[model samples]
Target: MDELGIIEQGVDWRTRLGQDIRDCMINDILFSLQTKLQSTSTTLIDLQKVAARIEERIHTIASDYGDYLRRICLTRGDLDSYDVLLNDCQRQQASIRSSILLHQENKQGDQIVQAKRNTMGTSSSSVLSNQVALNDHKEHSHPYEKDMISKLPNDLVQHIMSFLSMREAVRTSVLSHWWVNQWTFLKSIQLNIYWFHMDREKFSSFLDKLLLSRVQADAPMDTFELKSFAIDRANCWINHAIKHNAKVLKFAEYGKWEPFYLDPNLVELSSRYLETLELTNVALDATIFSQLANSCPALQNMLLTDCLLEVEEISSSSLKNLDIIDCYILKDLSICTPSLVSLCIKNERTDNSSFRNSYLIFATVIIIDASSVSSMELLAMDRQFTFVEKDGGEPMFNNLRNLSLGLWCINNMFSPLRRFVRHSPMLRMVTLRISPLDWKSHLTKEHQEMLISIRDRRGLILYIDWY
Candidate 1:
């Protein structure tokens, strides 16, 4: 196009004029653009001014907010200080109150102790007065002494003296006049001679004083107890208990301490009118027990502990309740009394003698303490003494109503159970325990069948507790 020289063509007439007009218009546009550019720069400068003002205002606000934050921090410190002081005051108050309560409790304890001390002192003084009164009566001699002494207004003296033990009663003679022979008439004699020499003669002499006094005094005895007494004096004391017809008798012995000598005749004589009898740690041949049962026709309750009772036939004509505890040497036990209602035997703790043969000697043995039950409990040994199947066949004790068997039993002598269930055709309930490891497996099919029959026939509950 440049080679064509189009620019040169504008030099021709009207075209040249038109070209001059366009150059003028271009100069006007350039001038207008310069004015608009200057206006835009001024507007930009105004906006910068406004932004600087706003930035200054924001800096002032931020400074004020910082002051407010400082004030809040100060207020917060004051509140924390107040809270700490208040808490300390509350703690101090609580401590003071606790101290007051402790003082009050201490005062109360002291008052109780003082009261008990005063009571003991009064009792001591009364005892001394009795001693003095008794001495005056004894020191003054008289042929009518026995009658006069008996006639004196001395019921309080006797009542007070009754509280003393056998040894203390005898020692009363050393006190004064009236006390000289006061112990001779004691009806309740409880002796505690833990250190009595086992020399037979010396013991017999000591017993002579007790016996001769009671005999001369002619007091019918209520209780005669020889607790852990020496063996030497056992004969004399046993004789005394028999002769006096004691009502409640408790005899206990332990350790290598002297053992008591027991006689069938003595037991019979004493037990004739006995109501409760408790024997612990005494060595007795089985023969004497039978005699005792016959003699104690009125016996209501009996307890035996750590004893060697050779009783093959357990018989107490009127025996209603029996309790045996840790009797290591028990052998050939039997129960013949229909009157027997409540019985408890606990041997799980420790007993040297368990079995000469199978544990089937006892009718039923229990594993746990049967004491809680109202009825008789053969307890831990419950299963041990149960019957093994004999050629004689099923036992026929149809009278059993409530029964408990132990988990340790072998030779599943459901014999006693079956017997009870059979005889007591209308039997109410029976409990059988079977230890899976026990040698007896009769508690298997046959036992279950018998249980089902009993349940169906008598509507009896057959409970089986497995070990």
Candidate 2:
């Protein structure tokens, strides 16, 4: 081969070697993380078991104290202290569970990286072997170069930082002066509080400082996500991000039952650049939707899960996709998003929740005014549901192409599935999924007949699956 060809082969070999080394490092890191995660999980489980045993013992003590332990001097405060200890243990358990979930997310990313590494290894090994001879001859010609990653432009470094978690990205500052400030220019910031071994106050303070620094640097934040148990303290920080034109905003609770409430003012101010918004375990009122439609012209997608909807109606215009999951407090849903292409409503069952109280009675009505919707999914559990259609007008989902209904929807007195098939002239597919409990009992012969009738008449396919 010519000198140029040999040189090119050597360079390629070096590149492949670097990539292989990086992949090996990544594998080592993943192995270490998995080991630590397993250890932490075992410890947390042990703590929970101990806490349960302690509680059982305390119960026995309380029961025997009134009669047999009167001779001793154990007061109610002692029992209360035991209860407090149990609560602390429970809190720690919850934090560990959250951390586990965060690690699981990272595990998926690691799998993707591993898959790429495997593909590269398979394709480059022969080429690398052939270049070994060329490498010896070119050793003096091309001396060891500076790290290519360190030589990357600031913009490229910032772009790379976008894929990393905020904690990992910020830690890159320790590498060199060039990277010390590059993380501040990152467009995406995603942090899970439980992943860091800091107290809530310190995490909050860190977020405050980070957001403040970004604002001072005039950085354009494309995404801002925070998952924490204590979101009340970060309300101001969220508001700041919205005001600064963050395009995507996501906030979710870590381990609390109570829903977080975002003031209407905050939602209203989040209109400018917010294209996607996701909130879990949030308490919302009726006016939240209308406020978004009027204020957030750029908004396209909204997801509310495990939330407490304190109102009867939800309506929007600018939103293109809407997802309402595990929100039991909403008695009615009114969507008027002309831009909507997809809608999903799901229920999370709770034994003693208010949603259960309306089981034997009419509970909620869903009215959709979106003419552009092409996909719809509903899982209302056992609640009574009514869909409002315009009087003496065409049905809303005339353009809908896909539809899904849960077990409760099949039992609705309104026959929502039949109505959907009758109205949705463009519907190409229908899927019906039932819970295991419902499938064993509630799936009737009549339901099967209805499914066959739709397929024969509409010439459409049907699917039934257990969920």
**Could you say which candidate leads in lDDT?**
2
TM-score (C-alpha) between model 1 and the true structure = 0.49
TM-score of each candidate?
A: 0.49, 0.64
lDDT score for residue 319 of model 2? 78
Where in model 1 is the C-alpha error above 4 Å? 1-184, 195-208, 256-259, 264-271, 329-331, 351-374, 380-383, 386-402, 408-467
lDDT of each: 0.49, 0.58
lDDT of 1 by residue, 357-389 (tens): 111123333212111223544545532453233
What stretches of model 2 exceed 4 Å from their correct place?
1-153, 265-267, 348-362, 412-414, 436-440, 443-447
Q: Model 2, range 126-230, lDDT digits (tens) per residue?
A: 222222122222221113544345578867777678787655564554345355556656788777665443235545656676677677778887888888653
Cα-based lDDT at residue 349, candidate 1: 48
State how far residue 462 of model 1 sits from its true place (Å): 8.6
